[model samples]
Target chain A: MIEFDEVSYGYGGGPLLADVSLRLAAGSFHFLTGPSGAGKTTLLKLCYGELIASQGRVGLFGEDARSLGRDDIAMVRRRIGVVHQDCQFLDHLTVAENIGLPLTVSGRTATEEDLGELIHWVGLDGQRQSRPPELSGGERQRAALARAVVMSPDVILADEPTGNVDWDMSLRLLKLLVELNRMGKTVMIATHDLNLIRTAKQQVQARVLRIASHRVQLAGADL
Target chain B: MSRALAILQFLAGDAQADRVVPPTGFTARLTVFVSATMAFLTVFALALSLATGRLAENWSDALAQSATIRVSAPDGQVEDQVIAVMDVLATTPGVADARALTDDEQRALLEPWFGPDLPLDTLPVPRLIEVIETPEGFDAAGLRARLAGEAPGAVLDDHTRWREPLVRAADRLRTLGLVSILLIAATTGAMITLAANAALAANEQVIRVLRLVGARDAYIARAFVRRYTLRALAGALVGTLFGALAIWLMPEAEATGNFLTGLGFRGVEWLWPFTIPPLAALVAFMATRRAAFATLKERR
Candidate 1:
């Protein structure tokens, strides 16, 4: 579980978010939607230990984020998976190597069967031998998601994961996220697509949070 | 120190062996070429310093323990004065030996400065006597007083006036050689450090990708440390090989020209140049390891 109390974040010059408090309990699903430049990404960064709160406290599992050192933050990150919009990857490494990176970093041995299963699950089996740059848009996103969950994190955060894919690919990606949530993983996604959220509401009991007025708010029926 | 450990690990195949960043052929070539050039120059500096040291020691030791006395007495009285000087020297406690130079020896000694045809017997030039001293050393003042009473024309030369300058020059050359070695070491460290920094900057994207995949600082740094350490080892090996060859090509001590003599490693001293390769590798290891960790932390 993650909690934020009176969290105000600014870049030391101008405030991007002011006096916003939020909580993400275990096994819950959420969508963070907002207009452009509405601190959606900034809020997600705060959720992880990437940015320290300028005003209040952010707790991960139960410990304060600010109190954690570098190693501590790294340990916490292993339990909390993050998928960036750009889908960063090592161009020199093959898709299979990139997919197994999380396990490799944690010093966990990934057997042949486990890796094969993961590739089949992500629908990247055919492209496993190719480099990350050689993959298509949809393939890269799926690859990034595969890397994100390779550690089997308790919480998964995706920032615009389906931004570069087609409508059919977006729904396919959404189904994967839904399947992880069904497995008792806490999922928080930040996206501007309202239709996706409306479609997601039919599959799972997910709450929507909207960012406006430089603060976060729980959107009512309109979402 | 850290470099040796990294090479051990890399050769042992304990590294993560990730291929996130592609290798640059140009940087590898540059590193090898630069290291070789620096090593060649360092070898010459080392030779210059060592050779001058042996010269000063030999010159000082030979001159300080002996002297030459030229007795300028009347032509017919030369034999009487030589016998008198011998008696005075034998009675002195520290006079190890006193012998008059033979006529042929005197002509041979003057042959280099004066032509061999110069008539030594016809000239009124004084007869020469060679004196050798013991460890306790003969006192010049007391010997001079005894020679003045016994043989008025005898004058002693202890060889002190020129001995100290030769020794000081030799000592200074030895210091210069040692300083040159230090400079070479420092240059190697700085160049390797910059090369490591450049390698880090070039692989910024690889680092970001690795970090995203849950790589720790240690893991990322290991990849870089391994690559650079190997590069340094290869570069320095070639450099050291060429340096040793260049040193060996020099005219050895027993060569014809005395001036060109002694310009190389002394016996059993060839082992010192062997340390350069490992030292270069060690420098690369430290520099790359530091740069890798620093960049990783900065990314975090």
Candidate 2:
């Protein structure tokens, strides 16, 4: 679980996110909604220990994030999977290798069968040998999702997982996330897509938090 | 010791670890070229140091075991004084043998500066006696005192003043050679560090991807370190081979009496050049690791 206790962050300028106290409990699903440059990604980074809170503290797995060394942060990262909006990947690696990177980096060997199954589940079986640059937007997102969950992490933090995909593809991605949640993994996704949120609500119950005026607030029914 | 073992283990990496970082051809070639060139120079430096060391030891040992006696009597009395000096040397405890140099021998000694056709008998050059000593050697001061009483015209020349400077010069040359090697190692480390930094900076995205998936800094650094180390090892091996070959092909040491021309390894000393590759690899490993870890910290 990750908790932000009255956290504030800024990049040598005024505060971008202010007094944002939040908790992501076990087996819960949450969506972060905000405008562009609204500190949505920043908040996600703090949760994963990439960016420490400038004011208060961010705690990861019951340990203060600010006190975590490089090795400690690496241990925390292994428990949390992150999907970037850009679907960041090594362009030179094949789709299958990219998906299995998490396991590889953690000093684990993923069997051919396990990698094949994951590739098929992501609808990338035919493109397994293809590199990231050759993939479509939706394929890249799905590949990124597959990579994020390859290690079977306890928590998944996704930032705009469907930003570059069509509505149908977005729903498919949401269903994959919902399936993960149903399997008892905690999930928090940051996005501004209301339709995707409504679509997600039909399948799974998710609390929606909106970032406005440099603070996080639980959104009303209008969202 | 544990760190050395860890480095060995890292160098003997698994196939999966090798694939973590994509190879950059330019950096690889750059590392190899720099390491090879540096290693070549290092070999020559090592040879210079070892050769100078041997030269100094030889000069010290040969000169320390002997002393010459010169008799500067009048032309008619030179032979009588030389005979008296020989008799005094015979009675000395540590003196092995002593004999006066013939006229041709005296001329040969001055052949370089005075030429072979010099009229040695007309000149007032003193008669020279060659002295060979026992292992413990004769006491120069005691002999000088004895010669002063027995043959007043005789001067005991222990060769200390001239030999000390020659031995000292050789020792200083050896030290300079050692300093040159240290400078070469330092220069190699610095160049490799810069190259590693550039490689890391160029592969920032690769590092980010690897770290996002929970790779520790050590794990990431191992990839770079292992790569640079292997490249250095390979390149240095080539350089050392050529350096040894060049040394081997130099004109034979016996062909020329010039000490500097006989600057290569001899007999078992040839094994020394083989160590350069491993040393270069160690330098590369350390340099790349420091750069990788520092850059990773900054990225975090």
Stretches of candidate 2 off by over 4 Å are: B1-8, B113-125
lDDT scores in order: 0.82, 0.91
lDDT of 1 by residue, B82-137 (tens): 99999888899888988999888988988999988879878987889999999788
TM-score of candidate 2 chain B vs. the reference: 0.92
TM-score of 1: 0.91
The root-mean-square deviation over C-alpha atoms between each candidate and the true structure, in angstroms, is 2.8, 1.9
Candidate 1: list runs displaced more than 4 Å: B1-7, B70-81, B124-128, B140-155
Candidate 1's DockQ: 0.59
DockQ of each: 0.59, 0.80
Q: What TM-score would you give candidate 2 relative to the actual structure?
A: 0.96
- Tens digits of per-residue lDDT for model 2 on A21-134? 999999999999999999999999998888989999798999999899988999889999999989889887888988988888888887797798888888998999999999
